[model samples]
Target: MSAVLAQAPAAEAVEDLAASLQEAGTVAAPPEDADAAIEEIGLREKESDQVIDKSDKKDPLYAISITSFEDPALELGELILKGLYEMKFSRPSKIQAASLPKIKMGRNLLAQAHNGTGKTCCFVLGMLRIVTPDTTPQALCICPTRELAKQIEEEVLKMGKYLILHKGIKVKCILRDERWERGERITEQIVIGTPGKIVSLLNMKVLDGGSIRMFVLDEADEMLNLGGLGDQSKRIRQRLRKDVQTLFFSATYTDAVKRLATQLSMDNPWSQIEVKREHIFNDQVAQYFYRTNGVTEKLERLTEILSVVNVGQCIIFVHLRDTVEQLANTLTANGHPVSPLHGRMEAGARDKVLVDFRNGTTRFLVTTNVLSRGIDVPAVTLVINYDMPVRKGGTADPDTYLHRVGRTGRFGRKGSALNMIHDEKEMVVLKQIEAYFDRQGLIKEIPPDTDGEEFEKILNVQ
Candidate 1:
């Protein structure tokens, strides 16, 4: 069997993600008892309802305002619309309401929406709408990681379930270990995969890009900024027709990423929707910091935290792969059930770890930055920065910090992100993150000596 095993979610499991989206909902009203962090990061969105179309037109689609999920401007097919509502999506989210119309218009899109803004549906719905359902690979979505690719494939299947049954729509996730016999061709109507696999297929003539109409880059910032992914992604685009409707979506973007995105659109007229920095962090996730004396104290504090708070699911992010193993062993020896995941693991083992984590069989996961982006688990209630995210030269990486905390507080569910600060050096990194987000003093500090009850009160963990 191929190392990248192919699997599909059962009909019974589709509602899990559908309910998560319903729980996520549209732009939520601000809470009454807002704190400083909430007040600072949760800016009222006034521009999220509008899309900026750069194309020249007398009657531009830039003004199409879709407040409800059933708006005719979306022009969703009967079965597709039925599946959407069945998935429990009552209305469009801020990003969805803004981007869906442009996608429906088949225009190139560059979107920078925050986490849990239903960005996946924007592209998935558009792909389903444009695809002929003949299973000829008309739409493609490229992700930065295999886990994210699998997650997206599940979303596509769930959202297009009705079309899948009656219209014969198919979705496939391409992974590095996928086996493609000589001269074999892709038959899925919509294909989601990592850049490496997609490029390999394109090179081998296994995935004919001639019929492809839409190209989506999920977590596009990572695709463009990561070492060789940018080149591979560019190669994949080269295989497709020049007129393919390219869509770039990420929670964060640097100026350089913006330039690369524009270039990828082939300088074609494209539409854009971006969130302000103040509105980037989710208000539902309470952020905190704990000061420990050293590594030993940090371990003790971590164990103590697990014993105290009611963690539905927690992800502990360390800076290195070695730390992942070390921490997992330490926690397990101390009577905690935890799983370790990293890039070095084989494809099958990695899949099992993620499957177990998503299904609630595993409550704690120790991993590197591999699981930081686009891997949504609704039950994840806590994120611990066992080690703060830093760039190659030890500078704080604000983009990664955003993604790390984003693991929790998915959609609109309440969650918490607790950062452990052991030394002055680590404290400086935290401050850098605060400065990057312009949220000074927002990450409140929890003294290491706090008792279990006090810790629970601080995090408000349910």
Candidate 2:
């Protein structure tokens, strides 16, 4: 394992670094154009991020601001720009413009921003730019779930279309139950997979790490703090070349996970763009709650809400896989065609479900927190928390709540989040989340027995 991963503790290291930087009087400054750029992009004021660059600068990026993908500072290739235009991305998003340049500078980075902020493109473009047209893997990205891994691979293929066709660059998505020849080596130029699978491949000599120049961890906080994943991720990084440019991107991070991220940077002079609690909530998402008597009543209310409210796409969050199954059957019997997604489902089934949902074949998706973090679907206009999110110790998981609500209101689109509160525990969780965001009355309760018309009016649905 790498020394940083196995080091005593990161608390002291982070504190020491803070003290040294304070004494040296070198603190991070907000980019002059960041606020103006946010306004230009129509990003909500709460969505702005603060960047901290302690990297050994080849060139300073704080003073640098990119207006478009064609900016000289970004140095995006002609083919890549073509791909961007084909994808309908006319200009750089807030996160993309800010982080792409630092990535181009080849500095190790830890970036935090809200969901739907285009963090995927920042690292995908970086990998696509750095990777040579080769037979061996040149870039590796590890995500927490198979769904997220597949999503990243799709982006790679979409952005690297020209590279794949003209330059013969290949991309691969590695997941469980995907077979590899007994002694064959991975020939893909870019590999994206889960931590355990990637670690296993590295140990078995199936995936070569010597040529990997850029490493990325999406939903990095979960990658570093979840059970067994932290160690597995470390082992994979330990096997990579010492000079690899590492990047960690997540919507939220605990203090402990933030320290772990700093340690993972190793000897590299790292940079970070972190988002505070105040910056995670989207003003475009109107939040509301419904009080029910019990689980049965919660189910009744959810079905009632779906019957009347007109939603383009919706996600219903539950707490357990059994709930997913139960609700899927119940809702279907109640005349709603809903899709359920969870870790226990087969990979093929999950993929088909997500594809159907994204393409408008399915209008409602019921699942746990698996799709809460990095999955983005712009058409989703409503999110129903059938069961309020709670940590294992029965505390409110405010971060998860933020991510779940973030699924809607994506990219400045108007959306709504309706929380179903039944018991005292659920109410407590809701209150804690409200306090976490420091907005005591932000989440208002729907009028008792609100009709579908009244619901639409309150949420300002178009």
Candidate 3:
């Protein structure tokens, strides 16, 4: 390690870098236009034409499949193979085919794959194989949100059920519901949770890292960004052993995330698998936009769109907690069954709201960027960005916009994303998002409130 890094932890290193730059007055101002903003930040658009499709043999990655379930590469036992059969996962998806081998070899991974592509299964299998009964937390899987943490925990339990029942192994969810006694050890061989809870356990000595050998970060792009969860995750990793194997999985990437990956996986124990932006966003969803005057007109346009669009299950993403509640209440008063979700909601209430949305009891969910990544609601058909995301200093949030739209069009199903632009400023942000998606007419500009036959003919609105 460098002397500076050794003296200061990763979190402090970031702060120190910022402080030093600010002190020198070298922090450049951001570009006014979103396209220029992306370039100013050193992020260039991905050049490609083909889109992502797991079932398409024409997909270049389709050639990369595993031949033998009995291969020693994965070293799957008979019981695990039988369990896989029971789950009806006849073949590994694109990401799984490419990632499983590298993971089993213990190489650190930086993978970018959309949801419903079986990426979780790849890490789950690796965790199952790596975990041993040394009576300590041997594996740690950290996610961005409690909802995603629970989702991953559910998959881990399902895939590793045989081990859980036969070998007396355990997979624990480290959310608020899990209670711990003072001075007690977390003996689970595999652990999964959000960042703060995991860090708190380490601090309290309740979850020792001495036995942790494998660290998996789901939605790693989000976890490694400049945010609270990212900070906590870095501190948590700093506490682990040097040789610990790390795996990063996400649906997208930016220059910052790529730089972080190279820095963390610097020992040459690393492998990267990234798809072109076009290849990831094409064909799955039809993107469209409608311009509004501002927030006042936005409410009217949103109501018009909702009344027109045939929403099977929809998620409308905004940029604030107050907006979520406001929109949810407004739509509810108009007789729509909508639920609001944000970071501040209580744990039980959050779980209940998500459950209701997932089970189709509530057909609409209004939320913040909190629901942007690692959220898999396969039934959703419509995603409306009520407000495009911007960085703290008003730079474009293209990565987040991609995640917001990815909520739909899962598993090769055709879905749709509608971006709401208020003015020239937001139009700039939308352009950056468009360029990130390869700008070849993927997103269409639909006039606001075009109704009746025109709505059906153009947008297939309900």
lDDT of 3 by residue, 317-411 (tens): 99889989989999889877689999999999999999998888888999998888867776788888988888887768877877788787764
In model 3, pairs of residues that clash are 52-279
lDDT of 2 by residue, 1-462 (tens): 112221122444444433432344222222345445443333443424544443434434442435567764455787787775565555566667567766766668888877766788889998888777668888899998898898899888998888888878899899988876658899988999999999888878899988788899998988998568898998898999886889999888888987887777787756777556676777889999989888888888788878888898999999999999999999999999999999899989999999999999999999999999778787899998998999998999998999899888875578999998999989999999999888898899997678888977876655
lDDT scores in order: 0.79, 0.79, 0.72
Candidate 3 Cα misplacement greater than 4 A, ranges = 1-65, 68-70, 177-181, 266-268, 456-462
Give candidate 2's error at residue 197 in angstroms: 1.3
**lDDT of candidate 1?**
0.79
Q: Find the 10 residues in a row with the least total lDDT in model 2.
A: 1-10
Q: Residues 115-226, candidate 1, lDDT per residue (tens digit)?
A: 7767887888988887775657888999888999988888888889999999888888889997898689899889999998898888888998877888999999998884
Taking all chains together, each candidate's TM-score versus the true structure is 0.87, 0.87, 0.83
